[model samples]
Target chain A: MKIGIIGGGAVGLLFAGYLGQKFDVTLIVRRELQLQSLLMNGITVHKGGSSFTTRVDSDLLTEVSMKFDFVIVAVKEYDLKPLEKVLELMDKNQPLLFLQNGIGHLEWVESLPHHNLLAGSVEHGALKENDHVLHHLGVGKTNLALIKGEWGAVEELVSQSIPSFPFLLKQDFEEMLLTKLFVNVLINPLTALTRVRNGKLVENPHLHQLQRDLFQELLLLYPHMERNVSFEGVVEICNNTYENRSSMLKDIESERKTEIESILGVLLEKAQREHHFVPIMNVVYRLVKGIEREGLGG
Target chain B: MKIGIIGGGAVGLLFAGYLGQKFDVTLIVRRELQLQSLLMNGITVHKGGSSFTTRVDSDLLTEVSMKFDFVIVAVKEYDLKPLEKVLELMDKNQPLLFLQNGIGHLEWVESLPHHNLLAGSVEHGALKENDHVLHHLGVGKTNLALIKGEWGAVEELVSQSIPSFPFLLKQDFEEMLLTKLFVNVLINPLTALTRVRNGKLVENPHLHQLQRDLFQELLLLYPHMERNVSFEGVVEICNNTYENRSSMLKDIESERKTEIESILGVLLEKAQREHHFVPIMNVVYRLVKGIEREGLGG
Candidate 1:
C-alpha cells in the first residue's frame, strides 16, 4: 500500500520512516530545501540512540499526479487550511487521519466521504529541519478510529506487520480525544504562554496551580478524564519530556496563531454543554484571547 | 488629644498632615534634613490642584517620651516588625492605627487590649523627602475599622471632622481586609514574581494571563473566602491605582521578601472552620510557598 503523508515536518517524516519499514511511503513536503535534501539523500531519522536513512518517494504536491491508499495531515493548526488541495488529491475511497491536539473540528473534513473519516490521537514529539533530518525526542504512540462505521482495515492496519509510531486502536475514540483535550488544555497553552518546558510546569509558581486548577475544572466537563488518564502518567510524560518545547510554545516563539481556542477554548464551550462551570478556563480563555488580539503573534 | 506618627515616609507624613488639619499631630520623622525641612519649610500637599504646607511635630521616635492618645503605624510592611520597640512607646490605652498594605501582624499587639487592634485602609499617594509633599492624587478617603472595639477620641475626631479626606468606619472590617488580601494575592505576588508594573500586566502574554486566571479563580474562591468583598470595587481601585506602584512592586524594586506569605500563605493552613474550602486560593498559596522556599524573593 502506498501512503501519502501531507505534512513535511517531524510527524510527517517520522510516520514516513515508520510506515516505510514495510510499505512504500511518499512524503509531501512544502519547501524546496526539504524536497531537494530528501530526494537527494533520502530521509535520515535519529531515534533510539542511532541514525537510519531510508529512501522514500519525496516530492512536492505539484510533482505528484497520483493517488494513494491513505493521506495523513500532520501540519500545524492553521497550516491545515492549505492541506485542502492534498485532500482533494486523495483517492475518494482512501482514509484520512488527522493528527492534532484538540477536537471539535470535524467540519474541516466535511468535503470528504464519511466512510473515509478517521480521527487519530498521537502522543509524541519530533524535531525536523529543512534537511529532512528527524529527531524523535520522546515517546511515540498513535491511536486511530473510524469516526462513523466499523472499518476493518483500520484495525488490520493497527495489527500491521510494521507499527507506525506504536499505533493502536482507541476504544471509544471520543473519550480519548476528550482526555487529550484535557491534557492539552492544561499543558500546551500553559507551556506556550509561560515559555516553560513540560517538566518545569511543576516548578513555576504562577503555573503549577493553574495546571492543577485547569485539570480539576476540566474534569467537571469530562468526568471520566481522570479515570482514563492518571496524574502520574501525565506528570511522568511531562517530566520525561521536560526539555522538549511544546508545539504551542514553538508557535508562540514563531509568532503563530495559538491553538488555545481549539484546546481550552472549546473546553469552555463544552462546559456550557455539560452544565459544568469552568471559571478558571474562562479566565485562561480571556487572557489568551487578549494575547492573540494584542496581535503579538505576528 | 496628642497623636504621634512614625516613619516620616509619604504615608506617615500624609497621615500627620491630614490629621494635623484638625487635632494636635506630631510626625516622628527621622533625619535632620527631613525634620529640619518639614519643620522649616513644612509639608507641601498638592490636592485638587491646590498646594499647601503644614507645620507639625517632625522628630525622631526616640524623642517622643510623652504618651499620646493615638499612634499611627505608617511604616512599610518590612519595616513594621523592626518597629516593635517603637510601637512599644505607645500608651497601653492608645489606639494604634495601621495605614499600610498587607496584614497588620498582631504578635506585637497581642499584649495590648483587644480595642487597640486598629486597621486603616486608605487610598492615598504621597511622595516625601526633604520636601514634605503629600499628593492626594485622586482621593484620600480612608476606611478604618476597630477589630477590637474600644471607644476612642480619634473615632469621634474623624467623624466630626469636615468630611475631608472622607474617613468611614469600615463596618465589616474583615471584608476590607480580604479586599486587601485579594490585592496581595492578585497584584503583589504576581507583579513581584513577574517583576512588572500594573500597566505591563496588560502587555506581557504569560504574566497577563496568569494574573487574570489567578484573579478570577480567587473570586471564584469568594464562596470559600471568609469575606465577600466586591470584585468590581477592587478592580476600580486597581484601575485608579494602575499608575501607582503597589507595596509588592516597591518591595521587588527594593529587593525584599514579598509578603505573599502573609497574604496568601495562610491558604495552605488546614481548615480551621467547617465552612471553609479555599480551593482557588490554594493555587496562589502553593505557587508562593514554592517560590518562598526557592529563595527567589531576593
Candidate 2:
C-alpha cells in the first residue's frame, strides 16, 4: 500500500514515520530545505527517550506526479486553500484523508469532486524538532471517519496500523471533529492570549472561570456536546498536558501564524448563522487575530 | 490653605509638586524610603525640557499627626480598604478628595462623616521617574465634581489653581467618573492583556474590533453613555496616547497587583445587580486577574 502525506510539519512527519513501518510512505513537502533533509537523512521520530529513523520516498509538492492509493492532507486549515487545485487534479478514485485542525475545511472539502473523502482528528501530540526530526510526546490514537464515499480506505489503514501507533475508526465524522474543535476552541486561544502552559488554564481560578464561560458559549451552539464531552473532560485534557504550551501559544511566541481562523473563526461563523450570541468567543477570536496581526506584521 | 496628599505614587507626587506651588502641601507617604526621599530632596516636576522643584512638607502616613484644612486621597482603589479606619479618624469638617480610578470607592467615601467629599478624574499623564522626580507627559486638566458635599472646599481649590495645572468643576460626579471609566475599561485591560501600548488598541484592526465590542457591552449598561462618550472618543484617546503603556500593562510587566478588581470587578458587580449580559467584560476581567495571579505568585 502506498500512502502520501502532504505537509512536512510535525503531524505529517509523525504519520509518515509510523505508517512507513508497514507501507510505502512518501513525504510531499514545499520547502526545498525540508525536502532535501528528508530525502537525505529520512524521518526520525523521538518517543519515550528513544528515537528511530524511517526511510521514505520524498518529493516536492509542486513536482509530485505519482499516484498513491491513499493521500493524507496534513497541512494547517489556513494552508489548505492553496492546495485545493492540487487535490482536485488527483485521481477521483484515490481516497483522500484530511488531518487538519478545526472543521472549517469541511465546507471546502465538500466542494471538491472526490469520490472517497476521509476526515481525521489527530489526538497524538507531536512536535517537530527540526527539518526531519519529530518528537512524539503523547501516545493518543488518530480517529478517522468517513466524510464522503466508502470507508474501505479508512478500514485498510486501521487494520494495518503499526504497534504503539494506533488508528481508530469512528462512525460519525462531525461528532469526532466537533469534539476536537471543542477542546481546541477552549484551550488554544485562551492559552495563546495568556501565554501560559496548558495546565494553567484549569489551575488558575480566574482562567478557569473564563474557560467555563467559553464552554457555556460553545454549549449554546451544540447543546448535546455537554453530554458527549463534559466540561470536566476539557479540564482533564489541560491537566494531562500540564506542562506543554498550546500550539497557538507556541505560534504566538515564535511569531508563526496560528490556526485560530480554523478554530474560533469557524465557531463564530456558525454562531452567527444560528443567531446565537457568543460574545466570549467573539472577544477571544478577535484577540488572537489581533495578536497574530501584531506578531506576523500584518 | 493647608492641604495634605496621601499616598506617594505618581499621581500623589504630581499633585504635591503642583499643588505645593500654590498652597502648603504635605506629602504623606506609606513607604519610608519615599518619605525620606521627599523630605530630603522635596518633589521635582519634570515637564517638557525644563524641571521645577517644590519643597513640600513630608510625613510618614503612620506617623502623621498634623491636621489639614483639606486632604487628597491619591491611593489606588484596591488600597482604600486598609485606610478606612484612618479616614474615619480624620477631622469631621475636613473635606476629602479621592483621586482614584473606578467608581467602586464612591460608596465607601459616602459613608464617611466628612462634611465634603469630592471625586476628581486626573487627566494629566504623570510617570514617576523615581521617589522624588515625576515626568508630566500630558497637560490635561483634572475634572472635579462634588460627590456629597458643600462645594466650599472644591470651589476654593478651583479658585486657587496653579499655573499650567488647571482644574475644572463638573456638575455630575457619576457622569464624570463614568466617562473616565469608559476609557479605562476599554483601554487598560486590552492593552494589558495584549502587552501593547495604548495606541495598538485602535491601530490594530482586530484589537480595534474587540475594543468596539467592549464599547458596545459598556453601552448596554449605560445607554446614556453613548451620548456622553462616543466610541470615537475612546479611539481618539488611544491615538493620543499612542506610545504610552497603560498603568495596568506596566503593573503586569512589573509583576505588581493590577487594578482589575477595582475596574472590571466593580463593573461586573454593577452588571450583576442590573442583570446585564457583559460576556466580553467578564472574559477580559478573569483573564487579567488570572495573569495577575500567575505574575504575583498568588
lDDT of each: 0.68, 0.90
**lDDT for each residue of candidate 2 in B54-172, tens digit (9 for 90 to 100):** 99999988878759888999999989988887888888888889999998988888888888899999999998999999999878899999988677756778988976999999989
Candidate 1 stretches greater than 4 Å from native: A16-24, A29-66, A77-86, A107-111, A127-134, A148-165, A189-197, A200-219, A223-227, A242-256, A287-298, B1-86, B89-97, B103-257, B261-298
Specify the highest-TM-score model's number.
Answer: 2
lDDT of 1: 0.68
TM-score of each prediction: 0.65, 0.94
Tell me, by DockQ, which candidate is best.
Answer: 2
Candidate 1 lDDT by residue in tens digits, B59-156: 76667774778778787665777777766555666788877665546444555543566777776665553357767664657778876757486677
List, residue by residue over A263-294, the lDDT tens digit for candidate 1.
87667777888788666676556545655544
Model 2: which residue pairs collide?
none
Model 1, position B55, has a per-residue lDDT of 76
TM-score, candidate number 2: 0.94
Per-candidate chain B TM: 0.77, 0.97
